[model samples]
Target: MVRAAVVPAIGAPLEVTDIELPEPGPGQVRVRLAAAGVCHSDLSLSDGTMNVPLPAVLGHEGAGTVVAVGDGVAHVAPGDPVVLNWAPSCGSCHLCALGEVWLCVNALSGSGEVYARRADDGTDLYPGLNVAAFAEETVVPASCVLPMPAGIPLTDAAVLGCAVLTGYGAVHHSAKVRPGETMAVFGVGGVGLATLQSARIAGAERIIAVDVSPEKEELARRAGATDFLLASGTTPREIRGLTDKQGVDVAVECAGRAVSIRAAWDSTRRGGRTTVVGIGGKDQQVAFNGLELFHWGRTLSGCVFGNSNPSEDIPVLAEHVRSGRLDLDSLVTERITLEQIPEAFGNMIAGKGGRALVVF
Candidate 1:
């Protein structure tokens, strides 16, 4: 039996409970989690914004040590530190063949499998987002495990699975932000802050960070925002003013809200690009004028996991963390135990902190 924070149903608070862990089946491995980052996506899953089956273990951003492996799993061994890749690629998929492995056809189409069973009623529990790191132990596909280097702290590397990959990938791959380009990022959450730092790494000349809360200003600037503004109706105009009325070359919406998405679109200059990295609710919609799409010549794109190929990108990101190029420390604002997940969710809902890690 292993301890886990399980969401009994949509809109229900997570409960820390024990569950029976099945041994890793073929091509699977059991990970003893060292740390898990409480991401907004987990919140979406719990609140019904993103649909998944009920009574699931909710967490994806995690790092851990492999404790056991099943048949045909040779790439990793027990005692090895690894980061979970929630969207593991099936190399033979059409998307993978085209080098767009981020959209692996089987990425979300699970086999309706259950890796753990409830201790009380023997109810089968789904592993949310495939990795299920809200537990002390989780069984996942061996391919979903990326080996971590020794130097990087497992606690810090936990977020590389999601936030860093998504944010950095959005800037470098989705937007292809160029040197000296002006950039605007809406939201200063984990992914948004990572985007801001990535923009700085990409040599963006003027980086603007927008958020509703005034408390995030210091952290936003530390993450490389040249200017900060409150998210509001006139945010686009303010961003334009900062860029000398030219607007930003790249505008990223990380808030996953309709207004922020529109703000991202409105803040980009003619022929510039706007990338939506947030996973908004299914019912939410962002409106745009039909004529404006053609007249503005601006590109609007959506990024999934930052279009990252986990096997290839995770190591590079780990290197960045080691070399001080990526500031994971400042991004981690708080650390708590596994039992504190509910409080972590509260903080996330209130937008109270940067990244909060459930450290073992």
Candidate 2:
């Protein structure tokens, strides 16, 4: 039996218990997790903000060592370190055909498949978001396992699975932030912190970090923000004030709320780009008049999984980490055991700290 944190049902409390993991079948790999990052997405899955099968092991950002592999699994072998890719693109999908693999239509199909069984009652268990990295060990499809980038510490690499990639992609791919350009990151959680670092790496002349928590000001500054502002009704105005009466050239919203998204858009300069990286519920709506849309000439887009191709991007990020251009350690505020995952989620809800890592 392998220990895992399971979400028994949508909107249910997480249960840390043992589950029976099956040997890898064809085209699958078994991994012994070393670490997993407690991401906000896990909170969304546990509370029903996002839809996934019930009674699932609910962690996706992680790194581990390969234990076993089934037939046709050739990319990694036993004893090799690996990172869990929560969203592995299906190469033959329409989006993949067009080179937009991040939006691949079949990425989450595996989330519905049963991969484990509850040890106590024999109830079948599903892998949440495909990788199910919250457990001590997990069995995942071969495509969901990627070799860890060389030179990165195995445990710290957990954030690379989700937060780091998403943040880096939002700045480099989604927003195409240029050096010497003004950039603003709304929210300073794990992903937001990554976004700030990425903006700094991209050489944004003025980096503004916004959040509801004033206590995070120093943390934000540490992660590369030149300025930090408490989020409020006049946040857009404050951001504009910092940009010489003009808003930032690029604004990325990591808060995932309608109000925050609108603020991000409003805080961007005319003809600038605003990328939404936060995942909010459908009920959180933001409205804009047709005239403003026509007149602003601003581009607003949604990003998924950082619009990142993990196979290609991880190496680049790893190089950045090696060169000291990126600080993965700075992204982590607390190191915890698997049992403290629920507490990590509570901190995320309260808008406290940076990433909380579950060290196995």
Best by TM-score: 2
Write candidate 1's Cα lDDT for 226-307 as tens digits. Answer: 9999988999999889888999999999978898999999999999999999888876688888899999999999999999
Worst 10 residues of 1 by lDDT: 107-116
Backbone collision tally, model 1: 0
Cand. 2 Cα-lDDT: 0.95
Q: Which regions in candidate 1 have their CA more than 4 angstroms from the true location?
A: none
Tens-digit per-residue lDDT, 3-66, candidate 2: 9999999877889998999999999999999999999999999989999989899999999999
The true-versus-predicted C-alpha distance at residue 245 of model 2, in Å, is 0.8
Name the runs in model 2 displaced over 4 angstroms: none
